[model samples]
Target: MNNIVSMAWVKEHMGEPNVVIADCRFVLGKPDAGREAYEASHIPGAVYLDLEKDLSAPVDEHGGRHPLPDIFDLTVALSLAGIGNETKVVAYDDQGGAMASRLWWLLKYLGHEHVYVMDQGFAAWTSAGHPVTDEIAEPTPVKFLAIVEHTMLVEMDQVQELLGREGVTLIDSRETPRYRGEVEPIDRVAGHIPGAINRFWKDGLTVTGSWKVADEQAERFADLDKNRELIVYCGSGVTATPNVIALQEAGFTNVKLYAGSWSDWISYSENPVATGDEENA
Candidate 1:
């Protein structure tokens, strides 16, 4: 299936055994509110993937806030949710694919490339007049085998090398406020990595909440040399994923993600932090 599927496409093939719909709605403020909404209503056969409980591992001083969970633990969770190696995962969320992109990236890192995020997410599904069910989908166990692709992840040392290195593009996916060090909401450090460019993840979408067309998305990166090594990161590495999708859609290859992102960078006092309105530096 395509990386971003339509509601009509889902409605047609949703009942297929290999098809698995996953709801990834998450609100940072109200941690459990997403599950509550899922219980109230979701697309039929959609299983919930909690951001903190499922998407992230135990946080510590070394790892960022949303470290990748253990492969064994994630595999067990995926098995319980009926996600096999061959399963086609369709992930969705209300936040313009912000939350759902985490699931998409995880599946890609696991070397399972048959996963996708719904454009406009649950909002589009409901807007299309699709029926929602309150009944919880029964867990159908499947043997999920995951092989982590290290190419999709980068460590602090690697990031350090890219700080002033040419031929590489480091993208900071946080908003202008955080990137500029004007406001410190979540982490100890308020600024971004030195020499990184700010490209807020939400900019990949339209005002209507759906992802921008590929050509429109390409325009956002027109200034960049596509031949360069592209690395994307955000707070805890969650929001940076949509840009990965956008980049891929726009046909820019050789992309990697700094999974620990700004959070992990700030954890080390030695890492220099950049602050200002500089979109690219």
Candidate 2:
């Protein structure tokens, strides 16, 4: 149930009778490449979750890339994966908690509390000499009941209210270029929300592309009081989950994801955007 499970911890837990391993490897370029990799070879008993097909709703330019899947649809997908209320879900991918965190946040959004994202993802697992198999896992249906927690998500209105409240820390998890409005490769807009601090999500990872130590990560987010509420946002809410996971791992007891993120914020005519590296607000 911890926000981030290190590669070592996952190796120890592999093949445990109660744990469910999910391969969430995804490539934005070849979108279907993740499923292909999963089919080629994955951890034994691991289930493949397609980010485009299984994890996201239909994409349009307006929806931003990898928009969230319907809540009920994702619930059905989890249920079909043999992930019941009691299952300890372990999600991982080649990318450092990028695609993997999507599944992690999805589980939390759906109110399943026993899920963890594998730090460093499958690459670390394979490099650690862990076992892998190509054989498919047969379906075993399980009961997954969602107790949705609305507070986990913050909408534009909620963000407005939080800005009015003093000492609110809003973090933008995009790269510095995107955060500075220097270059926008994905979304139509270039700038970030006014008054948000730039904390590139990659900063949470080491040069090896694995998550940093808990103490180090805690230090990165130490500017915000752990007890006070913090809001994390990124391009379309997909990438920000890593920051949320990192903050939670860092001992920030109260953190929420702005699911709509910069894209969603700009979608509305009223929300403000700021340019340059200077911290707003």
Candidate 3:
């Protein structure tokens, strides 16, 4: 009974013993604001996960803003957060799925499959009439061991190989505008990697903000060749997880996320970048 649970399921099981809920509510404006909000109010048993501080690594000139943290450090922090191997971790955030997917992908990278991003996150959780508590719950530290799976991640070399091979689909999860080189928000380069298709991550969610059902998701992605190799990317790899998670829920098994994503691709300057209404030309 403990796979990915919906907002309804979270509501039904709030305050249930041993249930570890993480408040991943984050704001790009005041990046530390999530921790501040957790200090102010959260679900009774929820723990705070700061997107900038706890979730991602320090920004360097190479990795852009949210680089992946060192595995050892992240595992220790997860253990300190009371998430053990067996603990079911549920992540949530505002702006739909952005921050939550970062945590979800990190957990998966560590080879823990018991974690999930809560559908709709705090907005849905609050709308469901769930009580918010000013009190924070302190729990004993649990051991979280890292077992990294290299295959779950894709690097630039692999992407280059895939580009050469036929029957491979490269998906860019950024919005149409960003993918089309309309604006450059975070990175200096606006357009996506060359030959990548656009499928914005926000489209994975229903209008109500929850993820679409499995059947609907599967049907939506049916047009894409499921049996062929599929790779997903986004700016610095933060927003790509919604599309990755959606592909998984859609029953596509051969999905891989480009961890370095467009940021790394653009860094080389030698790598090709296509722009402006160009469809795989």
Q: Which candidate is the best by lDDT?
A: 1
Put down candidate 2 lDDT per residue, 125-158, tens digits, no spaces. 7888988888988658787888898778887778
Q: By lDDT, highest first, what's the ranking?
A: 1, 2, 3
Best of the candidates, TM-score: 1
For candidate 2, which ten residues in a row score worst on lDDT? 59-68
**Per-residue alpha-carbon lDDT of model 1 for 101-200, expressed as tens digits?**
9999998999897999887888678878898999999968999888989888889999897777879889888898998899989998898888888888
Candidate ordering by TM-score (highest first): 1, 3, 2
What overall lDDT goes with each candidate model?
0.88, 0.83, 0.80
Please say which candidate is ahead in TM-score: 1 or 2. 1
Model 3, range 1-281, lDDT digits (tens) per residue? Answer: 32257877776766765567888888876877788788887877888877777877887756646777889988888888889888888888776878888888899889988787787778667777877888987877998888897778887878877784788888888889999998988777878777788888888888878788888778767778878888999987888888888898888988888877888788877778788764541
Candidate 3 or 1, higher TM-score? 1
RMSD of each: 1.3, 2.0, 1.9
TM-score of each model, paired residue for residue = 0.97, 0.92, 0.93
TM-score between candidate 3 and the true structure: 0.93
